[model samples]
Target: MTSVDQPPAFSDGAAVIELLNTSIGYGARAVVDDVSLRIDRGEVVALVGPNGSGKTTIVRGLLGLAPVVGGEVRLFGVPAGRFHERWRIGYVPQRHTVVGAVPSTVQEVVASGRLARRRWWKPPTAADRAVVSRAIDVVGLVDQSRASVSTLSGGQQRRVLIARALAADPEVLVMDEPTAGVDVASAEALTRTLARLVEDGRTLLIVTHDVAPLAPILTRVVAVAGGSVVGDEPARIALSPASALAGGIYAHPGHDPHHLAPDDPAGPAPGPGWLGDPGLRGAPAAS
Candidate 1:
């Protein structure tokens, strides 16, 4: 079994992620309201909010995955719509639905990340091969390089997805619900790997309903509510017992905070992070 080691990648110490009054949703009914955000190099930001509060919608807007009704989003300071520096950005979709039946080996899957690094119709360059191998090893998948993707565990699969993002050596990596249903060990491992990325100054923005798995390592948190930002503070502040209690739940099931009436809770309440034990992977999102 070949052992793969982590690599020192880069995020250029650049402010590569931003959103300005960004609004997004299906059809004409907007779910996300005008909101502006910025992420610099060497920082990690988490978006924790009540479900349907437009956290995912905001992320989709930045990725150009969802149409924005107002304001603008910039990647590397260029308008996101016209941003062609695809090679510099990496994204891990919330659903790895495409992995289930795929019969490709781990190396093959990681190597595909290089397609974006090359020109149209050209063969893979030796440098591209090196990057893919390094990416595989960095995500601790070297031993499974030749193994089929269908054979890996859920945690391994998630790591493989992240490796593809890292393989591209992107300046920004945006992930949605990255730790959903993940086991404690796998989630912690992911957090540690991400922490290493921050030490190396690679920017990361993750959208998760639960912050407990991510808070200890977070540099900041952007809490979304009512389709707009209600709080933009350090993770500790945003997830404070006082704040968390009043904020309802970030990513709670069947949540629709927009229509739900509000009432201020009288006192601080226990929560995912405030429980004092680094809790386990949170409840799963409904089907």
Candidate 2:
């Protein structure tokens, strides 16, 4: 197992997210303790472990949804607690969290991602609409742009949530269990869409239990168990049964070890850039 005691060397670029010996949980209890992790610009990272392993809690801590009882969490070089340019990071919650009983068009739901970039008193501009449209297209939902989110399949709805995050055009995207509970076909489709995003040079931090489908696009995998990271290694090693067993993470039956190799012709290319504007950075938050 790769040791987490020392920081890994990364390419020259600012870390998009950093957790320094951080402990996070709700109220007074700390779920994960003394965790130090960093995701540099352009890296596609996966936080993998069994359910309740504190992977989700770590993500929550980064988003400030969970209370940080120890250490620090930073976003784009600024302490997360003090960071105001939140528009720089897009988040996609689980699929179930996105759709509700209320009927809403795919376009409407995606456009909402721009809320952090638009002033409340002002309406969405042409550029905003264009960005939303591009996001929808990126997720291959152009035909369903006008379709109600409730009417779509679980996977399509998941794509909607992803499009919603992309609509914000954030530099770094953090997604939780993107392929969870989806049918095989839908999961494959989602993987292809993610491949496109990777090609566009989007920095992604994904939390997932099933990493086989996404193994191709993953650059690194950090295994968390018992509220602490047990293994950190390149995707090639991390996804193997030996490495997984070493970290106490179960390798689900039927997952081919060969797919764990990060050699997908459809995988992400080099560098950090946005979906629409490749050169943009540090986007201002909505007033």
Candidate 3:
């Protein structure tokens, strides 16, 4: 396993992410209602659910991508809206998010993750270059670092996106459908990568349909169905052979909730430059 540098210390027994009786949705419709969850430092939490079951909404709700209509949302013990240390939280969107008409090299794409933390006027230092290189190497894409992102396959692109998130060295890594559409080999590679990250003491919030690849390292499972948490189990119990026989740990169909249609009236409009991320520069104002 590749070694991640020593991570910044986190307060013991404190929640990295907390949602208390939270309600998240677009405008009038509530996708996730009264969903309360707490993710502690170094914990790997999996959010499993069916399509349109509010799993993605919950993730977005925490990121301030979705509307938090009610209850409380906090990150690092601070209210989500007031939290400004966004560079500490890394987000890997679906593979399609980075695909666009403007082609960028794998190195360039991964480097974007550092923008929030980097000074706008200063050039990248040796430390920055080193971190970026490590991120690429960890994803086993060092040879393709200089290649165009458009030239890579879908799985390769996903790995690049993951490398980008890792470049940020976030305390909490949030991934949506991380293994979706990847081949078995790529999936296994990602599994190992994630295990290494967990071993390095990084907190993870993963939203996916297949938990088999991640079951071993997962500390807790938060199953959502019908826009609510239906089951929460420990990894030992959830990954047991008996559990597989009794209806597997993961449910089918974890619909990607990040994509909000242009005409969707009830959904969140997006946040404006929230968390110092330029991509979200036009998102809706905080509630």
What would you estimate as the lDDT of candidate 3? 0.72
Candidate 1: residue pairs that collide: 21-35
Q: In model 3, where is the ten-residue run with the lowest total lDDT?
A: 278-287
lDDT of 2 by residue, 9-115 (tens): 54345678888899998778899999988887777888887777899999989998889999999898899989998888899996564656788899999999988
lDDT of 3 by residue, 1-287 (tens): 00112222332576788888899998898989988787779878778777678888999999989999999898998999999988788999966546768878989999988788799899999999888888887777777888888888787788788889989889999999897866544555576678778888899999977665565567777778788777666655554545542143333532332211212343222233222333212212101
Candidate 1 lDDT over 38-114, as tens digits, reads: 77776677877776788888888888788888887888878887889877878887864336465998888887777
**Model 2 score (lDDT):** 0.75
Ranking by lDDT: 2, 3, 1
Question: Candidate 3: misplaced stretches above 4 Å?
Answer: 1-12, 241-287
Best by lDDT: 2
lDDT of 3 at 63: 91
C-alpha lDDT score of every prediction, in listed order:
0.68, 0.75, 0.72
Backbone clashes in each candidate structure, one number apiece?
1, 0, 9
